[model samples]
Structures are given as structure tokens and as C-alpha cells.
Target chain A: MTDTALHTNSRSPGVIVLRWGLFLILGLFALFYLMPLFVMLTTSLKSLEEIRTGSLVALPREVTFEAWRTAWSGACTGIQCEGLRPYFWNSVILAIPAVAISTILGAMNGYVIAQWKFKGANFVFSLLLFGCFIPFQVVLLPMARMLGLLGIAGTIPGLIFVHVIYGLGFTTLFFRNYYVTIPAELVKAAKVDGAGFFRIFWSIFLPLSLPIIVVTIIWQFTQIWNDFLFGVSFSQAGTQPVTVALNNIVNSTTGVKEYNVDMAAAIIAALPTLLVYVVAGKYFIRGLTAGSVKG
Target chain B: MAPILDIKNLYKSYGTVEILKDINVAIEPGDFLVLVGPSGCGKSTLLNCIAGLEPITSGSIAIGGKDMTHVSPKDRDIAMVFQSYALYPTMSVAKNITFGMKVRGVDQETQDRKLKEVAHQLQITDYLNRRPGQLSGGQRQRVAMGRALVRDPKLFLFDEPLSNLDAKLRVEMRAEIKKLHHNLGATMVYVTHDQIEAMTLATKIVVLKGGIVQQIGSPSEIYNRPANLFVADFMGSPAMNLIPAKTKRNGTGMLIEIERAGGEIITLHDHHTESLPENVIIGVRPEDIAEAGFRAGEDVQEAECLVDMVEHAGADTYVVSHLGGRNVTARLHAETSAHPGEALKLAFDLSKVSYFAPDTGERLN
Candidate 1:
């Protein structure tokens, strides 16, 4: 892909003009997504006095790192002033296991639904698309009761299991479409060689399905990591994920508004997924193309 | 070697439709058998049934004198090469070759030796560390072959293993497979739709149509003595030409009289007079017909034809002509000067002519 840009300092006159035209459009779109993050970062660096005195877009009257230090260490999160660090740790514990289990089961389920057949595999698949449509709130009460009966309610395991269950439908669907595009004969060759179900999966399908796994891991990590409803509903106060803790700090009505610290906390909460996107950006598009377009 | 595999009245069906009907064959320990037919002829289905990848609705399959009708694919002790060259995409070429050995709990020493030998034969030693996705089509095909070769099972099955290759590669692999068979002397059943592959690879060729066996014989037998009209037409390139001719038996021979387009006629020499029918159809191969200029007048054994088209194929020229209100193709020597919109007398190869019953399509002795 040539990077078409509007007029640049090139010897060719008309070609540079056309190139510059395309670059002008592309640069505008890039700035569209980056502007908000820029504003938030700049606001997080402003002192409280500068924030009250100067406009939001104005440069900080006094530069300081106090807002970040306060957000990380001292700002109160529901009567606790440990700021967002503990909540960030809490989110890590919940997100990692949930993402791992969902991605693994999703790959296996997708592979089996696509390649192997037993009865009701179609039913299993239709149930996935079915879950994709229904909003998460519809299942919240029933899931809460189910977790309470299991006696692990308000625990990390409970939250992780809930994410896996809810995430299974979409993740499996993503994986099924991905694996279905793969040649079924590869799986059959393994079976004729006396490989059982899990053996063929681990050795053949799962390995070839790495791209989709990356996509699945990234998608579910963002979804589970930032999920507020399930984290707060299924978990007690101590086990609440970072999203819930962040919500308590930023949405508090009683305290005087500290927009600088609030913006910093929000950025901190979003950093893991945003960093992942930036690093694996090329892979994300490649994986989607491999899964959907080819299929 | 005595016969090691036998299929007796094997039948398969999907719901209400029959896919394979009464497929029966027997092969010796070192015999190479080929199942061949047009697409949807159920040749692949029959091989799948034998490998126990599919169930047979009737009949039994036996290997090494043991019944394996309901056996699973693994328990049958058979190795199969799928058409798609289904290599494990995640495993290295080395791991793919050793996978079967690993599952069977083979000692690592023996596993290493067999893997090395098969890989060397397939010429994939340099790529032993790469995954299947990283290899070319021909290279992946070799790995698939190695996966099966490493197993050393009692029977080997190949399902159109070269169909995915280019024409040149297909020919190369065809010769390689034949050479491999010579070295191993293993019992193998291979399926392919290519007529040339069937002719070159099989010790016995089974031609199938509409899910039924049309003929089963050696390559020469299939070409020279087809069992019926369908078998005769299906096996040959450009197909055999058939003409309606009147038959008359005298002594030990029969005469066939054919009428040409412009009311000119010719009488064929009667070769087989034993039990000849009055209404007979004469069959001749295009290669058997030769272009000869008319000799003014000859009532005995020459066909006058108007040349319609000329197809030059380097070694010989094929002239398609209109004779007896039907198209007849004649093969001419490269030196034989003939052109379109001309008339000539084409002589049929007397020794190669065959007769068939008009109504039944069966060979008439």
C-alpha cells in the first residue's frame, strides 16, 4: 500500500498534489481518535488552581505530576484513599483468567463445531448467535442467583467463570468462523493417524488458529477488564474489579469534583487494552481478515 | 503373494440415496489397485468405506484374513493419504511425521530412524523444522505422504493424492508413487479420476459408473476388451466411434455393410462370425482409422468420407469426417497430406474392430 499523501516536497508536480490530497484525509481521521486522549492527558497534568482559573483547552498555568500521584496513591475510592492501584490489581486478577479460559474454550468449541460432528452441533452454534443478540442485563439476575447458589458468589472465581460463560458465545462464534475456513482434511488426517479429540485440537487446529486466539484474547480482555455490571453484581466490595472501583471514584456525587484526577484514573484504567491495540494493531486487522473475509 | 484384502458386496447409502453399490474387489499383498471413474461415481466413497472412515450398509471388509467391517479407522491398521494433504499446520514437518508413532507409544529410537528415512525419501529434510503453512503445495504433499509412510500399516489408501498438483508435478509424483510401490511391495488401493493415472499406476483397474462397477481388469484388457459399450466409450480419449451396420454371417465370419453420406457404401471384413446378430453396431477407435485416397472404385473395405476439420498434434493429424451421416475421426500419419473440404477413403483397422448388440449395448462375439 502506497502512502498516498497531498503535495509534498517532491520533484513530480501533479503526483505530489494527488498524494497530498489523500494524506490530508488520512491525517484528519487519525487526529479524530487521538484528540480526546490528548485533551485528557493534558488535563491530568494541570494543577487544580490552573484547572479552575484557566479554560479546559488552555495550557496549564503550572505544570505538576501531583494529579497522577494523587490518583495512584492518595485519592479516595469509597472511604479508601489507596486511589486506583488496588483496583488496577483487582482488575488484573479478574481479567487474566477470564480471558484465558474463554479464549481456550472458544477455540476448542469453534473447532469442534466447525470440523467434528456429533448431534446438536447446530443447536450449539445457534445458541452462540442467540447469546450475541441478547443484552447482558437480561441475564444478570439469573446469573447472580446461580453464582450465589454455587457459594463462590462475590469471589474472583465467580467473576471469571461468569465472564467465560458470557464470553463463550461470541468467542466461540469468532473461532468457529475462523476454524471453519481451515481445511477439515487436516483434522481428519490427524484422526486417521489415531489422534483423539484433544490431541488433534492441541496439535493441529489450535496451533493453526493462533491469529484468531490473539484476536479473541485481546477482544475479551478489553471486554472483561472494563466490564462494570458483571464485576459489581457478581463480586462483593473487596473483589470488585477496576471498572467498578474507577466508577466509585469518578462518579462520586459528594466530593468536590477533581476533573484532573478523574481523567488520570480513566486513562489508567484504559491503558492496558489501549496499549495492546497499539502494539498488535496490524495483527488485529490481519486476524479479522483471516477469519471473516477468507471464510 | 496371496490375496491380503477382500471387499465382499460392499454397499453404502446416505439416507435414501445409494452412494456405493456392491463394490467388490480382492488384492494380493503387493498388488496396486486403482478405483477410477468420472466425478460422483462413488470411487472415493468406496475407498472411504474400506478405510472405515465411513460405514457400509451391507457386505464385509477383510484385511489379512481378519474381518474389519465395523472396525474404527485406527484399529484397521491402515494408513491413508487424504486429497487435501492435511498436514498438522501447528507441528513441524518432523513432528507431523512422528505424530502417529508418538500415539502408538513407539520407542523414540525406532521413531527417529523411521522419521528420518521417510523424510529423506520425500526430500523434506531441510524443511523438517517448518510448519505446513510455510511450505509450498508440492512440499506439503510430500509431508502428507511421509506421515502415512512412517506408520508402516498393513494396508495403504490414497484418495486422489495428486489431484491438487499441477499437470507436470502430477506426472512426476505418479512415477514416484509407482517406484515407491516397487520398493516397498505393499498392498495399496488408490483412487483417482484421471484415466492416465489409473492406467499407469494400477495392477488392476476398476472402472465404475453410477455407483456400480462397470469393469475390473488390467489396463490392456480394459482398452482391448471392454465389457460393454459404456466401458468402451468411457475408457478411451475422444471415445470410440460407433456406426449402425447390417450384419450377415457366412461360415465362421460375419459381414457388416455400412452406407455413406452420398449413397456410397462399404462392406467390412467379418472377423468374428460365431453367433453374430443381424443388427450390429461397429465400433472403431480414432487411432485405428487411416486416411487413404480413393482408388477410383473398391467395393470391399474402404470408407469414403468428407473431411470436416483437421487437428494436428505434432506426431499425427486427426481428420474428423462425415460418414454414414455420423462423424468419424481418422488418425493420419504426419506425412499424409490432407486438408478440410476434401474427400478421401479412410480405412479402419480390421484387427481392432468390435461389434455390439444394437438393443443391449453388450459386446457381440
Candidate 2:
């Protein structure tokens, strides 16, 4: 007989019980991750009166689209009312450019600093890494001043630049470590074949680096798209990201809090990145594990 | 053929530690040179230095009679097959093989023609459209070679290219590489730790140790005349039996007297002008010993031994026996009937022996 024969293990009661118990515990933990979003979705469809009188977990007796409708097109802000419809479009416009440009720059920076070695390159890498560990407030003043000097203060460009700069630290860290694990010989192989640095990055490194790129895009989109601090600080009141509008709507003082509209608007603001994760959740997990295992 | 490549007084170091010292070699056109050594003996480092992946500390490397000391690896016109078969995982076999041509702006038709020639030769035409991750290990390795072959460069460097294969596949691929070298008449330098690979593929073999070349010669020459004790030990499997002996001045010549495990004295024929030191060593290949029944003869030397065990492998029997408290092995023809713990007489042929200074481990010849 050949050495490649398959063998089966005899079943044991203790093993069977342990397997079932493992699945049960895992099922319970899965519910923990999902319960909060479930509660929020159900609550957004309930009337304010019903939400106040009813238990948090109970299904609404009267389902209404009033909250979603009000959140979308009708909202009062200190006597003037306009729905989040205008703000929703504004958020997407701000986010798409910010995410794309930031990711591209991040990918380039990751590729360069990871693959090439020049003098003081590690110092540059260390500074970028140092940027990652600092608090957001710490950079707000210097960034504001830098933008002020550049003639882009209190504009979308100002906020866009800040997002890209801050996002680079983490994105480069991710792509740098991931590319470091890639066999250096592949780069040498391409180089030996007459490929230049940019050509190597485009033809060889970029294609194989998809998993990490996907990961960086997912992570940076969420960070920049939902950012309220820079959105409030860098952008003017007229040109603010939708986050500025959402914060204004939710935190208005001496006004009646419309919890349902607030909930619906919150989901609207989060929908793009959340939907992205839903579509490419498997890739996120793959990217994380692939980057980690070699490390 | 004249030499296609020359490396003069090569040196390499990593920070404070020197990895290669004064490595010098010459490769003839269409010649296959195998750099055989243990790991960290600088074989791979030498190959890397030749490929321009690592900078030499001080030396001259010339290809085709032109100095390429500072040439970029790409400008050197050499192709390398890495040990890991470093295929771009995202690229298909055809794309990986044509990547070099594409980068050099060679037109599509020429690229496709060259690609077809290599693919057909390596038997990977059917898998040309598949990415490296989708292929088997052997297939990936073939693509790696195909990637190198498409360039048709001045020289080829292989860094332990077959070390990752299973035993059966290794033998098959070793033969394939030998055939490939023959068909192309390409100058090649191969690195390997496998002695069999060195013996089978090399027109010249360079054995190395601790960043130094111990010997460089044809396989028969290296096998018959290793330059040092380390080379002698490293060159053979079921390694050469190293018998420690004493040297004494006898008449006008020096004599070597070895003490066997059972307190028996055995003399080896001296073949050198250097006076044998008090401590000398004799190295003999296992197959050089045979049965002589403690005979009474001038040329035959005998030692009585108890057979430890016998391993019969179809065509030969490997008999492990004890001599003067040392384990000595004898490879004999297949019909041996010696049993364990039984007394037997083993004979040594004097002409096949190698002598060394036991203190320095240097060969006396």
C-alpha cells in the first residue's frame, strides 16, 4: 500500500460533547457582536412616545417611516428647518475624494518606504509611526496653522489635507509591514528583468498587495468619513462635512431631542462604510490574517 | 572554451562578521560549476555577490573579459533562479516569464515566441495562464526556471534550486537541469549542499567551509583528493572513516600506526615527504574495506571486528563493526552473511588511504 492512505478516528463521547459545547459558546458570542445594531434599527422605527413607555428590547407595535422621512428631508435647527438630505450628499462628496486620494498617497508612501532604502528613510518611517500614536487634538492646532499659511484654511481642501496626512501614518504602517513580509527576492527578480522602481511597484508589488490595500481603504474610509473633530475644526460652517451637520442636529441645546430622527440620521451617516464592510467583510478578515501571520 | 566569467579575490562581510574571504573562481562557457558546501559556508553569499545583489567588499568580477565590478544586476545580463522559486504570486506563468521582455519594451510577437520556446521546453505550456499560487510546487519551480530562461542572458545562477523538492522529484529535476544545461550549452553556476547533486551535475565542484574554499576540481578529483580533513568529512555520506593514529620514525621514512578500538595496531602506507607528527589521522572510504579472514599476506592488512549490525539494500550491504573502541563502517557487495556479535576479518587497501595532521585537521599529502 502507498503511504498516502487516509485513516479515521473512532468517535468518543467526551470529544462529541466538547465539540457541541464549543459551538454553543461561539453562537452566544456572535449574538453579543450583533445585538446593539439590532436594537438601534428596531428603535429607529418606533414613535418617541412608544420608545419612552416601552422596554428597550420590545418590538414596536406601531411602525413608522416618519423618523426616516424627517431625518432625510425635514429638520429644525434653531427655527430654520432642513432635512439631512442635503447633508447626506455633502458627506459622500467629501468622503469619496478624501478616501481615494488618501488611500493612493498612503499606498505610494507604503510602497516607497517599505521597498526602497535611502538615507534617513527609517527616520521618516519612525516619524510617521510616531504620528500614529499621538492624540488627534494634539495635531489640530499645528494643522490649522499649516493650513492657514497655505491659504486653504476653513475649506474642504483643508479638511481633506488633514485627513490624508493623519490617515497616512496608520495606512503606511499597515502597508509597510505587509510589504516587508513579501519576499524581497521578487523585487530583485523584477529589477533584474529591467524593471524600474515605479514599474516594479505597478507591475509586481501593487497587484500582490491587494489584500493590504483593501484593508487600508476600509480602515481609512471609516476614519475619515466619520471624523467629527477635523470636520468641525478645519471646515467652515458653510462648507463643513455632513458630520458637522449631524453633530449640530444631535447636540442642539434648549431644543426638543428627536431621538428617532437622530437615530435614522446616525445610520445614514454610517451607511457607506458599513455597507462597504458588509460587501467585503471576508477580505478584511483575510487582509488582517495574511498581514499578521508572516509578521 | 575560454573562461566566460572570472572572480578575483572576492570578499564580503555583514557588519562586523566576515561571510566570505578571498573567494576566487573562473567559469568556462557552457560549463556547469557547482558550489557545494554546508549552510553559511558562503556559497549563497558568493552567488549573490556574483549576481550584484550584495556588494563585494573588495574584488573584481568580470564577464566576457569586461569589468562588471560596479554593474547593476540588470546591466550584468545574468538570470537567477532563487531557492524559494520566488514567482510573483499574482502573475500567470506566461506573464511572469514575459515580464522582463515587457519591461525592456520588446514587442509582443518576440515576447510570445520566446515565451513559447521556454514554456514548451519546461513542459509548462498548459499552465501558462494560471497564477503561481494555483500551481503545484514543481510547477512553480518550472515557471521560475522558465522565467529565467526567457532572458537568454550571458550566464545563469541557481541558488540551491532543487533543495525544496521531495526526494523523488529532486532526483528527477536534477536530471532535467543537467539535460537543460547540456542542450543550451549555457554557462551556469549552481549552489547546493547535496553531494550527489554536486557529483552528478558539476563539470567542476568547489567545496567550501567557514567562508573559505577547501577545494575546487572535477568531481572525481575532489572525491579522490580532498584538500583537508573538513573536505574529506563533508564530501561523503556514511562519511569517510577517520582513524586517529600515531607517527613514528622508522628507518629512513616515517610510518603511521593507528590504534584500533580493540587495542590492535595497524600501519598505513606513508605517501608524503612531511614527517608524520605524533598524532596523525587516516581517512578511508567505506567501500575500500572488504573481507580478508585475517590473512597472511604482504599487501593485505587485517583487523578482527565484531559485526554490530548489517543493513542489506538490494545491491550492497552496509556492515557496522567496532574496531579499537571506534565504530567503523564497511560497504560490501550484496552477498554478505555476517551476523551480529560474530567475529569477522576486515581488510583495507593501503593505496586508498588519506593522512592528516590531527592537531590542525590539514591533509598531510
Candidate 3:
């Protein structure tokens, strides 16, 4: 008899029970984690009366697109009365440039710290890593003043600038740690192959950076898109990001509380980040664990 | 022809700690120079310095008589194969072999031609489209060689390229590398901690220890006449057996007196004019020692000793015995009858022995 057959024949009843028990515990945790998202979807689909009287977990009796349309165009956010559409665009405009600039800059920083090491490179890296630990609230006043001096205060560019600066610490840390796992000999090999600094990064290192880039982009996109603090602090009503707009819509005192519209708007504001996670979640997890394992 | 590579008074240091001290080596057009030593011996550091990857603290490097001390590695016209076979992980084998050419703006036609040639030479054409991650260790190593071969650079630097391979594959690749060198007649400087690789592949071996060049010579020169005790001990498999002995004057010749077990004194005579030191080490290769009745010759001196252990290794048996209060190994013919605790007669070829000063570890004669 084969070893495989022998191993299969030796399975104990306790092992099967343990496996089923593990699945049961994990299934419970997954359902608990997804409960909020389920509640939001159901609430967004319900009419005002159904949402007011129905239990939070109950399925919508009559799903309607009216709330979605109102959330998309008719809702009020800070006297504008136009919904999250404009602010969603604002978040996009803010996040694309911010994520691009920060990720590129972080990749370059990581390359330098990992490959072109010098006497004080580690010290510089350590100092930069200290930025990741600093609370963003601590830098608010200084950043506002700096943005004011730069003549971009309360503008879209100002928000992008703020996000990039704040995001750089984490992005750089991620890229640096990931790039450190790559052998320094690769850089040496490229140099010997007549590849200069930028050329090597573009041809050699950049192609190998797909996993980390996906990781950094997804991280920065979610952080910037969902950011209420920086958006409210950096930009005023016209240029405010979606997160700030969503907050304004839910808390506006002048209008009657449209709970269904608010839930729909909240869902709208979260869709992009959700979409990103749904589309590239595998790459995200892979990137998170890329350099952790020794190759 | 002018030397293909020249390093003069090269010194590399990190802050206050020196890694390489005034290393000087000049290689001709087709010389295979192997920089070999134990770990932390700075062999890799020196290779990097030569490749222009590490900046030399002082002194200058020249390739084909062009000074390259301050030149960036890209413009230095050198190619290197790393021990990890640092092929670009994401690129296919074809792309990897052509990356250097692409960076230099070599046309696609020439790139294809050179790629095919290198792939064919390294027997990696079948794997041209596969990524480095998919290739086995030996195959990845060949791809690395293909990348370097496509460059056709003035000098090739190999940093322990075969150290990652299995022992069987390492032996195979070592021969293939030698064959490649014979075909190209390229100037190559390889760094490895494996002395067998150094002895087998290097036309000239530079033995290093503690970041200092211990000795530099041809393989035979290094083996037959090592510059110091370190090189003598390092270059051979099983290593040369160093028996500490006392040297004295015997008429016009010199005599080395070694004490065996049971108060047995064995004296060997050497003809040398230098003043004899009191305490010295007598270095003899393990293979030079044999059974007394086996391969007896004029220079062979027989000594009766107790065999402490015997290890059979197919064709030959390694017999361990006590000499001068230390274990000495002898490679005896497999057919010889020997066992532990048995009295045995061993022959030492005096002509093949080396003398060293015990205190300084320097070769005395």
C-alpha cells in the first residue's frame, strides 16, 4: 500500500471534529466582522418608513433606487444642496496625484536607503521612520501655516500636498522594508551591466516592484479617500473631500434627518475603497507578507 | 600586452576599521585570478572594490590601463555574477540577458543575436522565456552567466557564484566555468571561500586572511610552497598536518625532532643554510604520508606509531595516529591492513615537508 493510503486510513475522529470546530469559530468571526456592511446595504435599500420601523438586520421589503439618486444628487452638504458627487471627484483628484507622488518618492527613498547606502543612511532612515509614529494632529498647525505661506491653503492642491506629506512616512517605510529584502547584488549587477541610477531603478527595480506598488497604492488610496481629518482641516466646503462631505451630510442640522439618504451617501463615499479592496485584495495581502519571509 | 586589470595600493576602510590593507594585484589579459580566504577575510569586499561597487579609501584601480578609481560602476566596463545569481526576478531569461544591452541602447537585432549566442553557450536556450523564480539554482546560475557573457566586458568579476549550488552541481559548474574561461580567455577575478574552487580554477590564487593578503601565487606555487602557515593550512582538503617540532643543528644540515607516543623520538634531516629556530612546525600534506612498506622511496623516512583510528573512504583509508602530542592524519592505500590500537609503520616523504616558525606562523624554510 502507498504511504498516502496508509496516512488516510490512520485519520482519527478527533481530527475531523477539530477541523469542523475550527471552521465554526472562523465562520462566526467572519459574520460578525461583516455585520456592519450588511446593515449598511440593507438600510440604504429601504424606504424611510421601512428603515424606521424594521429591525436593523432585516432585509429590505421593497428595494428602491430613489435613495441612491437622492444621495448622488439631491442631498445637502453645507448649504450646497448638491450631494457627494462633487466631493467624490474632489477625493479622486486629491488621491490620484497624492498617491502617485508619494508612492514614487517613497520607492526612490527606499531604493537609496537599501542600495546606495552611505555613512548616515541608516540614521536618515531612522529619522524618517519617526515620522510614521508622529500623530497627524501634532503637525496640523505647522502644516496649515506652511500651506498658507505656499499660497495653496484651503485648495485641492493644498489637500493633496497634505496627504502626500503625511502618507510619505508610511509609504517610505513600507517600500524601504520591502526593498531591503532584495539582494544588494542586484543593484551591483545592474551597475556592472552599464545601468546608471535612474536606469537601474526603471529597468531592474521597478519591474520587480509591482507587488509593493500595488500595496502602497491601495494603502494610500484608502487612507486618502477615507480621510476626514486632513480633508476638513486642509480644505473648505468647495474643495472638501468626500469624507468631509459625508460627515456634513449626516450632521447638517438645518435639514430633516434623511437616514436612508445618509446611509446611501455613506455607502457611496465608501464604494471606491471597497472596490479597490475587492479588486486587488489578494495583491494587498501578498504585498503585506512579501518581504516578511526570507527568500 | 598591458595588464587587463591593475590595482595599486588599494585600501578600503569603514570609518576607523580597515577592511583591506594596501592590496596590490595586477592581472594580465587572460589570467584567472581567484581571491580566496575564509569568511570575513574581505575577499568579497576586495572584489567589489575592483568592480567599482565599493569606493576604495585610497589608491587607484585601472582596467586596460584606464584609471577607474572614481568611475561609476556603469562606465567601468566590467560584468559580475553574484553568488545569489542576482537575475532580475521579474524578467524572463531573455529579458535578463538583454537588459544591459537595452540600457546601452543596443539595437534589438544585435541584442537578439548576442542573447542567442550566450543562451546557447550556457545551455539555457530552453529557459529563455522563464522567469528567474521558476529556474532551479543551477539554471539560475547559468542565466546569470548568460547575462554576464552578453556584456562581453573587459573583465568578469564573480562573487562566489557557485557557493549556492549543491556539491554535485557545484563540481559540474566549476568545470563548465573553466571551460568557458578557456574558450573566451577572458580576464576573470573570482572570490570564494572554497579553497578547492580556488586551487582548481585559478591560474593565480590570492590567499587572504583577516583582511590582509596572505600570499599570492600560482596554484602549484601556493600548494608546494605556501607563504605562511595560514596559506599552508587553508589551501588543501583535509588540510596539511602541522606537527610542532624542535629544530636543531645536525652537522652542516638541520634536523627536526618530533616526539611520538611512548617516548619515541623521530628525527628528519633537511639541508638549509638559514639559522635554525628552536621551535618550528613541520607541515606535510596528508597524501605524502603512506604505509611504510607501500610506495617506499629514497626520501621516505619510516616511523613506528600507534594507529588511533581508521576511516575507510572507498579507495583510500585515512588513518589517525598520535605524533608530537597531536593527532596526525595519513592517507594510506585502501588495501593496507590497519585498525585502532594497532602498531603501524608510516612513511613520511621529507622532501615534501615545509618548515614554519611556531611563534609567528611564518614559513621558515
Candidate 4:
């Protein structure tokens, strides 16, 4: 191995040192970033006594599934002992519909803004982009009043609506930037081939949109699933999302603080997003850079 | 029969910016009409207007004796091949060819049969199952053509279809397209900025500049008797040389006087004497000038000039010399031995020369 390394090492000493220096810096940064996640995983697997007595970075002496079970079914959140299972399901119901609806709307909006342009299309798009910049707190009061007027102020449907409304700005921006990279000639060719607006979108634009669709779905899924602001403000106790329930469980002032249960619950709330990143993480970068590069 | 396509006084504008003005074109059946111009000359704009892709600010368009000024592109019965070969990227070759038919609700059997026929004709049968991204540039161009061919529309439009191919492929595809036009005998309206393509493929050429039509004529007529200076200079390779001269009556005929280097004046008798302009520009093609003693005739005039440069192009050697204080190029036979900085006698074919008014650039005779 040493002889092979010597044979293959044709680069000069200065370049080799620079390369190793870069890897060293990047390796240190990655370790720093992974430290908190490592602690969270080990802490969730340990007992409350071990968490209090052991070093924060040490691996668990005896791994157990009790904290996971307790976090899933037995932990208390403000007057109920039922754990994060119900709120986890609430997040599921809220996120799925919100992601699907907002993504479809964003695709349509992108198609119109990119291809079927009209007189005030730029003005309208600029107005839509402004939604991405505004502070979420500024809209809380009006959104609350509007939800009350709609008679769904503290319901799961209201929370879904809130997430979809807020998510459109980002989804549209992603899709618009992506679709803009497609040549306008394709749309023209489709038009000459007898495809109308909806037909073109369904046949031509939709099939080529898989990359951007993945981008939008992942973005909206993560944003809505982890959202605590609207989840807490727009929904009442029964329909509160996982993020709000997890917050209540960890910060409750009644009993001894169960750091193990809190860590397990936090990991549970974050599991879906983590799984998505691990599974489709390669597609995430690919989709974000889809139209920016040309063949 | 009436013309297959007719555009009458068409005008297109975007707010205050006029993109095309007073455009008039009439294409007969089986005629290959080419719109040739420089970039931003509204050639592509006119083609899009005919295809109903762009709404005209004024005037009307008629195809197959039907007024279609406001008709949608699909209903207008026209097929277009874009410069980019805009095949549906997600679709296979077969699907790309049949997409229009499928959208028009053609039966499945008919779509399959048409797709097969077009695929076979374009020699893309092997690539039927492959998507456009998997194909090379030439294969993709064939697929684009197949998509247009399957429709059998009233008119065929090509928007710089060969501009994206490599030079060798462009030449091959150019010949193939010409042969296809010949075999189909279909009316085609082609747009390109290539003068060679226009000269070789067009039955009628419309030259445009800055959103206005300059002239419309056959390739030979446009090459031989261009209506204005822009057409003359824009239509040929290496360009025709325009030499400034003065014409006056000498005995009962007109004599044109041209000044050379070292203040020497040379006189040539003009064939047309009546109403000749006082100050004129003489336009001579490079082929009309030859090395002296090679094709000497009674009408040819000889002039002694210093050869500035010699370029050998295998078939012909181009010799550049000073005439009227401007570098004038002359095409000589390949066998001619010409060298720079040497005084060589060259013959001018006066019988074929054209005289134009210097001020207006209009042909005088």
C-alpha cells in the first residue's frame, strides 16, 4: 500500500499539503456539527439517572427502549397524559394535504408566470414574492381573526390552511426559477401542436417537473411538519401539532424534568424529516440545481 | 389556383416598438419561400406571425383561401420546426412525433401508423423508445422533422432548423431537407440568416432589414440584379465590389472614368448611354474580373494595377488590388501565377457590369 501510494502520488508537496489542510478543516467542521446530534441520540437511549450522572459526550452504558415507549404513549402535556402519538398524527394530516396542495398551486403559478405571461404578470409575481419576506409574527393577529371568522380558528383544517398559505411563496419561487430554465420554444412548439394551456401543463410541463416537484415537496414537508408558530397559534389543544406538544412536554413545570423523555420526543418529532433527508438527500441538491445547469 | 399562403400588409408591434411593418408575402403551392436577413431583421418575427404564434398589430393572414388573422396556431394547419428542435424532453421519439395527433384526438391505431411511417422516413425507427435527451443533435433534428411531417399541415415552417447542427451535419441535413421538399412538393416557408442556404434552397427569397422588406425575387434575379445596394452586398459571399466612378458623354456614347492609385484615370465605355448619372458606383462581381490574356474579348478592358494580396482557395485564386482608393477583389483562374507587389494586367468584363447612383444606391442600368 505504501509503494502504491508513492507511485500514485504525482502531485507536488505544496499541492498535497493544501489538499490535506482543506480536508482537515472540513473534517473538523463536520465533527463540530455532528456533536449535538450525537449527544441527542445517546441521551435519548439512556436512563434519566445516567443522563444526569454521566458525561454529556459519553455513550450510554445500558441502552433501553423505555424512553421511546414512554415518549410515544405515556408522557404528559398540559392536562393530558397521552403522549406525542396523537400530535404526531395531527402533524401528518396537516403536512400531507398542505404539501400536495401548495406544490400543485406552485406548479401552476410557475407555468403561468414563466410561459403564459400577461400584462401584470410581473407585478403579480412581485406581490407574491413579498409574502416570502414578511415576518410571520406580523400576520399572526390578522390570520387569527380570519380563522375565527371562518369558524375554524383552532382546528386541524385551519392549521393546514395556514401552512399552505404561508408555503406558497417559497414553493412558487422554487418552481418559477426552475421552470424559467426551460426554453420558451417548447411551449411554442406545444402550442403549434394543438396543446392548450392545461394540456401543455399536463403533458409537457408536468413530466419534466419531477425534479422541482421533489424540491417543493421536501421543502414544504419539512417546513410544515416542524412549524410550531402556526401549529400552536392556529390550533387548540386537541388538534395541536407534534411540535407544540413536544414543547409543552419539555417545558411543563409540574414534575421532575425528564430529559431522556424530552430527548426521545424531540427525536420522534424530527424523525420524518431526518428520514426524508437521508433517503432523498441526493435528489435535494439535484433538484435545487436542476435548471441552473444546461446540458 | 390561388396562392397557398398570403400575408397582406401585416404589421406587428409591442406597445410603441414596431417589430414588423407593412409585411406582404404570397407563396404559391409547391414553392419554397425563404426569408433571409441579418439578426434582428424581423425574419423570425414574420415567420411566427404566419404561424399564428404572434398576434399582429394590424393586417390579415390567409391560408388555403381562408382568412386566419386571429386563428389559433393549431387551427391554422401549420407545422413548424424550431431552431432548438423543441422535442418534448420527457417523451420518447415515437411519443414526441405523435403528441400533436394524440392531442387532436386521433385514433390510437392511426397515431401508431403515422408514428411508424414518420419514424421510418426520418430513419429514426431504432430510436423509437429512446427519449430526446438520449439522442444526438442530428437524430434529435430528425425527430423534430418527424413531428412536423406526421401532421401533414397546409404549410411547413422552418425556423433556422439547421443552425444548431455541426457544419458537416448542417450541409448533409440541408441537402436532405431540399430533397424532402422536392419529394413532397409541399409549400415551405423557411427562415434563416445564411445567404448560402437562401440561395441554394429558396425558389423565392425575401430580403429584410430593420423590420422592412427590401426586395423579393428569385435567387438568380437577386444575385444578378439586386434592387438596391443592401441586397447586392448581402446576397453574395465575399460581396460584390462597388467602385466609385464618374460618367459623362464621350462622342455619342457614355464613358465611365475611374481614378486609380498615383492619380491615373481609366475610362470604360458604358453600354447604355441615355440618361447616365454624373456620379455613379460601378458594381462588379469578383468572377467578372480575370487575369489578362486568359479570356480577352472585344468588350473587355485591360488595366495595369499592383496586386496587393493573393489568396489560393484550390479551385480559384483571389487577387486583391487597389481600384478607386478601395481594395477590390478579383477572382482569377487557379492556373494564373499572381504575386503581391507586382504589377499585373487584369481584364474587366464591361458587358456585364452594373451602374448604380451613388447617392440613392439604385440600379441605373
Best by DockQ: 4
Residue lDDT tens for model 1, A1-295: 1344433334387877788998999999999988898789889999877888888777677788888988887778777888889878988988999999998888888888998876889997998879888899999999989988998899999999899998999899999989888887776677679888888887777767767888888899889988999988887878888888888888763556998998888888899999889988788888888866752
Off by over 4 Å in 1: A1-22, A25-29, A253-255, A292-295, B120-137, B249-252, B274-278, B291-300, B358-360
Name the top lDDT candidate.
4
Interface RMSD of 4: 0.4
Cα error of candidate 3 at position B157, Å? 1.3
Q: Please provide, for model 4 over A39-116, each residue's C-alpha lDDT reduced to its tens digit, 9 standing for 90 to 100.
A: 888998999899889999999999988889989998899889898999999999999999999999999998899888
Residues B68-143 of candidate 3 have per-residue lDDT tens digits of: 9999888888899999888998889999999999989999999999999998888898979999889899999999
Candidate 2, B1-365: lDDT as tens digits = 55788999998888778999898899889889999999989999899888887889998999877788899888898999999888888888899999999998999999999999999999999989999888987998899999999999989999999988999999999999999999999989999999989999999999988899899999988887778899888888778888877788777456767665554676654544347677777788887787765333444466666789998878888889865346778887788767787877788766667777877888886
Per-residue lDDT of A68 in model 1: 90
* Top-TM-score structure, candidate number: 4
True contacts kept of each: 0.74, 0.76, 0.93, 0.90
Query: DockQ values for all predictions?
Result: 0.62, 0.69, 0.80, 0.89
Give the candidate order by descending TM-score.
4, 3, 1, 2
Clashing pairs in 1: A5-A19, A5-A20, A6-A19, A6-A20, A6-A21, A7-A20
TM-score of each: 0.91, 0.88, 0.94, 0.96
lDDT of each: 0.84, 0.83, 0.90, 0.91
Checking candidate 2 for backbone clashes, the offending pairs are A73-A83, B260-B324, B261-B323, B261-B324, B261-B325, B262-B324
lDDT of 2 at B63: 82
lDDT of 1 at B113: 98
Higher-TM-score candidate among 1 and 3?
3
**Local lDDT at B134 for model 3:** 90
